[model samples]
Target: MAQAPPMNVLEISAHFRVEHDKNRRQFSIRLNGSHDKAVLLYDYVGKKTVDLQHTEVPEAYRGQEIAKHLAKAAMDFVVEEDLKAHLTCWYIQKFVKENPHPHYLERILH
Candidate 1:
């Protein structure tokens, strides 16, 4: 499906923080209640690749475009760092498939 451009529900705030959540088994995106919100999780898998391995939304958080928000944050990071990503995570793969503008495509895919 042609998903709308992902928004950044995960925002930057004065208290912005990204830390591991042992309970969720992933990094937690959080803020101190500014215009920021936590909407996704990810971590590094290798030197050049980040594993956006498990992306989820609490049931109540569903359909608010939270996953898309996460995609935006992740991809923006990839682009900012001038990095090539390996999307081992299925949801991330799906995100790329749904938002193909060539900018996000890995070299191998071309």
Candidate 2:
């Protein structure tokens, strides 16, 4: 049987979709008709691990929990792809520490 999707998929805002740019190694969210974006950056380590490097939200977009959305999208991707996560971004680190999921939590690399 197939496992359920991570919480992020159901919880992510319908107003924006997190777009994974594999070539750019980042996940990004943009509001409709807006150039400004919230981004989560990551880099692959070998084949199975990803180092979550940084998260950024435009000044105009701050205080809207966009960072949290980005974190959720990134984590959801990690769980979906069966990849391990090494969190270097402080926001993402705090996100995982604060919001624990049974299956998703196991994917974190110390």
Candidate 3:
């Protein structure tokens, strides 16, 4: 049997999709091409202020900018909802600091 070639970042990312379960208070993305693969998890606290609590990406997906995508989605949700943000998650705090988007930064809870 001929072996299949590995997928590039764009191809891999294209196959994945993020789901926001408001009931569960989490954002997740399943790994592509594997039914049993671990998902990237982003847990948050939502109210007047949405506290980004934790982020866990599968080891295999690290360095692929998956976490960045997850953070962006969560931040975008906060912005769209007109709520403040509390960065309790270290990764999220760092992401906001490094990326420095004015829209996101303006909503951060001091």
Q: In terms of TM-score, which candidate is strongest?
A: 2
Off by over 4 Å in 1: 1-39, 107-110
TM-score of 2: 0.84
Looking at model 2, the pairs that clash are none
lDDT (CA) per prediction: 0.56, 0.84, 0.70
User: Across residues 1-110, which tens digit of lDDT does each residue of candidate 1 receive?
Assistant: 87554333334333344443433434345434444444445555556655566676666556655566566667766776666666656767778888875767752122
The pairs that clash in candidate 1 are none
TM-score of 3: 0.75
Q: How does model 3 fare in lDDT?
A: 0.70
RMSD per candidate (Å) reads 10.7, 6.8, 9.1
The lDDT-based order of candidates, best leading, equals 2, 3, 1
- Better TM-score candidate (1, 3): 3
lDDT of model 1, residue 85: 67
Q: In model 1, which range of ten residues has the least summed lDDT?
A: 6-15
Which ten residues in a row are the worst by lDDT in model 3?
4-13
TM-score for each candidate, following the candidate numbering: 0.58, 0.84, 0.75
Question: What lDDT does model 2 reach?
Answer: 0.84
